[model samples]
Target: MTFFAPRDAETSLHCPDCGTRLHIARSCREVHMYCPACRAHYPLREYIHRADEAMERFLENVYCDRIE
Candidate 1:
């Protein structure tokens, strides 16, 4: 079978204001990281979404590789 999407890769999140790319960093139990684009920061929810998406793709890739 053919695979789609990046394997275990982080999603490139762009800033809404300046279009600067952002990376997710786990802060404290309360927060995540800074937005380079808007300069307005966000919470863990955003990190969770990105992390989950990356993790899912990661697992899928590992499984697919093993199967082949």
Candidate 2:
């Protein structure tokens, strides 16, 4: 099963390959951009500049867990 953070529709992040909207998804240890239509995963560093509210929320949770 895929684990994705809640998406923010106002975020305009899109897949580089298919132009589909990207979602914030996490694996066992990391979070990144995921394109459901293209089934592609992109590293956060590559898209951090374009991050929106959803990505920000996901990152906050990730770091909070690590700190505690």
Judged by lDDT, which candidate is best? 2
What is the C-alpha local distance difference test score of candidate 1?
0.46
CA lDDT of each prediction against the hidden true structure: 0.46, 0.68
Expressed as tens digits, the lDDT of each residue in 1-68 for candidate 2 is: 97655432223698889998887776667767778888888877787777787677667656433221
After superposition, candidate 1 runs with Cα above 4 Å error:
1-11, 31-33, 46-68
Name the TM-score of candidate 2.
0.70
- Write candidate 1's Cα lDDT for 1-68 as tens digits: 98564312334566555667654443223224456556656553544445556444444434222221
Clashing pairs in 2: none
**lDDT score, candidate 2:** 0.68
